[model samples]
Target: MRNILILLTAASIAACNQSSSTMNEYKWPADVKPPIAGKEPKEFIAHGDKRIDEYYWLNQREDQKVLDYLKAENTYLDTMMSGTSNLREKLYTEMKSRIKEKDESVPYKDNGYWYYSRYEEGKQYPIFCRKKETLDAPEEIMLDQNKMAEGFKYYSIGGTAVSDNNELLAFTVDSVSRRLYGLQIKNLVTGVIYPETITNVEDNDIAWAADNKTIFYVKKDITTLLGYQVWRHELGTDPAKDVLVFEEKDNRYYIGVYRTKSKKYVGIYSNMNQVSSEFRLLEANHPAGEFTIFEPRKENFQYSIEHFNNKFYVLTDWEAPNFRLMETPEASTAKENWKEVLPHRKDVYISGMVVFKNHLVLSEMKDALNQLRVINQTDHKDYYIPFSETVFAAFQNVNPDYNTNILRFSYTSMTTPRSIYDFNMDTQQRELKKQQEVLGGFKQEDYTAERLWATARDGAKVPLSLVYKKGLKKDGSNPLLLYAYGSYGYSVAPGFNSNIISLLDRGFVYAIAHVRGGQEMGRQWYDQGHLFNKKNTFYDFIDCGEYLIKEQYTSTAHLYANGGSAGGLLMGGIVNFRPDLWHGVVADVPFVDVLTTMSDPSIPLTTGEYKEWGNPADSAEYFYMRSYSPYDNVEKKAYPNMLITTGLHDSQVQYFEPAKWVARLRELNTSNNKLLFKINMDVGHGGASGRFDYLKDKAWQYAFFLALEGKLE
Candidate 1:
């Protein structure tokens, strides 16, 4: 490996001509060259297929050569984007001004307390607080995360639980940005944190038993980062003496433990490949009792359980593709003994359910939109909470009481701020508790949002949600940004983003493409977008971009694309499929080396996601993945301007994936378009931990787009 410092110094002198009056006239000096990684060819032979991967040496995280390359890439990114430094700062300040710094969340009543979180004027983290039984009661500070995170560069608080006696608080903290949390118990009354800390536990896996002294949590596999072991710990006892309550032997399944909303049972759930799941239950009162299987696991069968009034409600996809609801007595816990509560509708996908004493709430998806259905358990009558916007998102909020008629949920659209509401199931009335406050005189009336459908090559209608400033002309000259995440059955909702207002105010249209790999249109949508049919996801996004161009919303010269993680994979795919469709692209923590990563089970999500991306061990699946893999398919062609970002500590998609991808793209690309990579040394998959700090990354991304569009005023 060459000394990067010497090369960078030489390139800096050669690229000194940075006096362009407009961003569109800027160009890289012919003598200046980006850092070139050495090719160490590694051959992977599987199923009689031979593939040689260069830049494979970049995966050596401990090697100084690999570190030098990554640092050089970061330096190159800084050098290339130096001209936009002022614009980036301006954009950052513009976006940050819209946020209300000293804000508090709407309090929700739970376990005889009104719980909420609040942020101080200049704090990066929130303070967890609660009031006893009434809104007007004296506030009790549960946890001051800003104080706890004072010395850490990256910090996050995961699941938190108050003991049954309300004297102790169990919380998980992750300081390394790897999603491996450390469990700590705090004495709320004395304000003393216990000395015993359990390490390597999964986030959001902490549950308190009724005894209050005993709590259950899932431990992760150090290598794969899978939470496979459930353990029980007693207060004031050494964590080394904790008992292993359950261990999932299957590597394909991840497990977690939680207490039921009714407070009657503690359940451990095991989910496999997103296609099958099984549950085990133990009476909450019996902290020492053994768990009994709620139902044995079966292939392609998935069900979730909730308890209420001595009966267990089950949401299952047993014979329905979109899922249905069923119920059975607590004593007779078997699929055969279950009776239908709500038959599955072909058009409506039941995503989740909440059980209450007198009413049941179902969160459903129809026409790529969220719908909240409330049903009276006594009268068996149901009604949906109506939303006027054609493209909006609604989700059930915290309703821990299980005995109240009031259902709390959140609603938001592209043009609307996120608002919390309390809806009465009995009276069919709704009360607005609070809406997110956008500072700097923000007004919803100044913006407009609409839904559009694009026709794919196979005649599939892909939904697109777009928002822009009012009185915008439908001209082909406008700049538009398209985003999507079409994988893992995760739907990209048309939610509100106050940060996007900066782009809207700058005459840029922001849109979300609800492509096929997501569950936006139900299970069938996901089924068609993954595995052998994964290319459909990329095609759908391309079609949406073309549709916008055809409708005079934007043209290829002014179109931009952005996606993160799996959506980053989408960005990689689309750029390969149709490089000329985008003027600029931003891929954050992308998974681009698909065939190689899928073939290695040691990777974090490889084995568990075989069903989503086909198992490459099979010969047929190998060829299919290779057909569209961004890294494998990189050819000698002109490529779009790209900004690739990654975190060195990212656990979901290894940082090496994008590092290797940038090297390969630069090697094969024949165009002079900007190809830059930025690596965050302190963060993970989710960028910076601080609330306001993340906006800097967003501002940098927006600056990239604005610079390309010549809007860098």
Candidate 2:
């Protein structure tokens, strides 16, 4: 509320699509619609801010009337932030005290170090990383400061990926050039760090090849978001060993790569957001053909694949409305390229492939919950691993030593804390390596998890997960915080967060609205909510909110909504479409300007998102997207109190979108509840780099939700 001042730029948003849709040089309106997944955009137009602002502001008489009406309503800033913060502070303090009741000693390492990052309030260096844990927590120092003083600002360490041989460690660094980052490789044995080796490359995504001979990274020209290419670099090849790899002939397409069972393939998924994807595969060996383009099931369908259990497994809806996988023998790209390992079904999706020794683990998507399916690739027998209704999202890289026998995976959900566990591929014996426990002495028994359902306007069922204290009654009188992310075909996986403990301990229930635009309910579920059909997200969230109150999980007076980025669009649409449904809303780094944001060619994410958000100016699809553009739909009413925060460095959802949305909301709302904006100046789309800072913001956000639910005050 106090510090941030919008710097040099204060322009309206632009709209466009991915795949050279951005590079094609198109004129944009001063305003645009929200981003939705659909066909490539084909038109051009400009919007006047005055047109929409007049309904909320510009016209003093009408604006003042709306403002006066909202002035007397119970809003978030006055009720939720004030009340919830108090309850959370009390609950968090109580939980921390209980945990501290014992001076538990965690194993410390020698020459071993646990490193973390830091950002000072007003120093010349805005960001730095500190070494801790292995040694007693010491004075935090800048990460790789390396004696450079003036103008050597804006550097932070991205997460690291170690080579299989442990010889090289490739990481990314953000120098803030147009707010893009570069991938640099370092010899772990030699202590030789390659800073700026892949200089000025856009995006922080980088991966190391299995042979360790090459490191692959993504590069996008600063001038054009659509001009993106994936490149590979071999050490000692040149000053940076930078060698051009596969540069897409079509600037509209983008590629994603992942490793599967003894083999690695760069998945050439999609160029734009048009819902179509297929990939060309590259093997380390094979002179006759180093890479083979896999036959696509359909031109209209897009997909992603994972290699596990000696089989080529992928998620696609080619065979049916829902996405299943066609997997073949892992090493035998020799004969047939891909075979239907799992035939498609119209009802569900199969994801998260984890190959343990000779066995495979998969997460099956059936409407709401993710079911675990483990099978022996050779014997073709079901392991029937039951998880007591817990959603097993996906399995990450397993530890090497147990690759042949035991399988390790990390799983989380709304109610459970994120936990890392290892299981035997044969006996299914499980050991818990880590459970993000309450910091001091908090107990898991204090919380309970449940599945709830709400039917959408189209008679579609939305499954939701709720986590809260064990003894809470069914009367729904408890304060509620509902969350959702209904875009990108990405299913919101159930995982645990320690912060949820703070809320559960305070009698607050956290609910996840498993809505459309996500693969949670399978491919058809996603299709039902994308691009022109995007309004399904709002209707889904509203249904979830109304269901909560109807079930007595929470009163309408105590209901709150929260989402960030794509999900932020969800929060925006909900309050705008159904204002009386919520007490408070937190839309973090939201893309509210939708159609206009997509139209902007200069914005980092527009071109790439066109497939997701229809190009409003050029296509009939734009009319569908126009129906849900929130910025253009705000009504003169007592809207819920809101908090919109973003990072100045965020490229995905530009800071201007939230800033302008707030500016408009201030004029439109009749309520006097404070609308707060917190900007993390030195970070990107996700906000801060450090885990502690993220938790701080998380607490602040939930505190805001509590204030809205009437608990904090």
Query: All candidates' lDDT scores?
Result: 0.90, 0.61
In candidate 2, how many clashes are counted? 65
Model 1: per-residue Cα lDDT over 1-713, one tens digit each: 43333256755644653633653544444445688887778899988878888888788778888888888888777777776777789888888888788999999988888999999997889999999999999999999999999889999999999998889999999999999999999999999999999999998988899998999999998788889899999999999999999999987887899999988888999997559999999998998899999999998999999997888999999998899999999999999999998998888899999988899999999888998999999999999999888889999999898879999999999989999999999999999999999888888999999999999999999999999999889989889999999998999889999999888988999999999988889899998999999999999999999999999999999999999998999999999999999999999999999999998888886778888888888999999998998888888899999999999999999999999899889889998899989999899999999998999999889988887887767
Per lDDT, the best of the predicted structures is: 1
Least accurate stretch of 10 residues (summed lDDT) in model 1?
1-10
Give lDDT tens digits, candidate 2, residues 545-609: 99889889998777888998999999889988888888788898898878666666666767667
lDDT of 2 at 505: 60
List RMSD in Å for every model shown: 1.6, 11.3
Give candidate 2 misplaced runs (Cα > 4 Å).
1-156, 163-165, 175-179, 202-213, 223-227, 237-241, 257-274, 285-291, 296-298, 303-315, 327-337, 389-403, 413-415, 474-476
Superposition error at 203 for model 2 (Å): 5.9
